[model samples]
Target: MNALLALILAAALALPAHAMPDLVILVRHAERAAEPASDPGLTPAGEQRALALAEALAGTRVDAILTTQFRRTRDTAAPLARAQGLQPQVIEARRGGAAEHVQAVADAVRARTGTVLVVGHSNTVPAILTALGGPQMTEICETSFHHILLLRPGAGWMQLGYGAPSPAPAAGCL
Candidate 1:
């Protein structure tokens, strides 16, 4: 674990001071409508949740946003990005599996400084959190979208919830 943190920190050292973040915020994208499954956008409820996310972090200084190319992730990040007057950097989900995707996102994040919000899918969020030096995390419940995973150097991980509470664990997805 020490070696991993050292490696992550070493990679981050080259970035400018303003780009070096003391905190990294990771979250699964908000809810999605059932139609057009390939690249579904946020549902009305999800939009509200996104706004809630923006409001939740309004007081904090977020210097950068990272998101996948998917519509749901982009839409989920939109509110916060707009609120901060920053564009969310879109990292393609890419082929090669979850580890590859996680590395891509993690590397992109390491290159920047300041606080950042990474909008990833349920499957990706757990790995991304771990890569950012947070604790090992299982995927959020499929129905879950309210979890906000916060990580800072020497701070470990803290889980917080915003917007509507997630429904109890059940089955399937939209």
Candidate 2:
């Protein structure tokens, strides 16, 4: 009985004092210009939105930032990364199959403490969120650039607008 009691106490002590909720902030890369190159950089408005994103998240304690290899995603996350004194880690964007990449990112996030920000394209944002155990969301529209999706694993998810509120939805468009 004493040996079993000791084992129980040891196991209890080994567990974390408190489990911290994982906070994942996912955003779609800011507006991009229609260019001939396969990967185009951000436009002037996109630049402003990027800065606005930095300001919006300045108060939060972001432990890490992740972005795809593309310029647009990297550029969108640059300001915040610089402000937080963190270099954005480059993750591969979904090409053929995103399941592996998404699972890898989700695992990395689960192993960390504090908040994490992932800047991805409109098409990949929803997939990332889903992989992180968040709700399924529609693809972000080309013209909409201000949606910020906050995911707390085991808790819930919420969508908030940052920078400039997305232009009022077009008529007849939900």
Best by TM-score: 1
lDDT by residue (31-60, candidate 2, tens digit) is 887784889999999999999999999999
173: Cα error in model 1, Å: 14
lDDT of 1 by residue, 1-174 (tens): 999999999989976564346889998999988879788999999999999999999999999999999899999999889888998899889756889999998888888877989999988998888887777766777899999989885677788999999887655431
**Model 1: clashing residue pairs?**
19-113, 20-113, 20-114, 21-114
Off by over 4 Å in 2: 1-21, 168-174
RMSD of each: 7.0, 3.4
Positional deviation of 39 in candidate 1, in angstroms?
0.3
Give lDDT per model, in order: 0.87, 0.83
The lDDT of model 1 is 0.87
TM-score of model 2 vs. true structure? 0.82
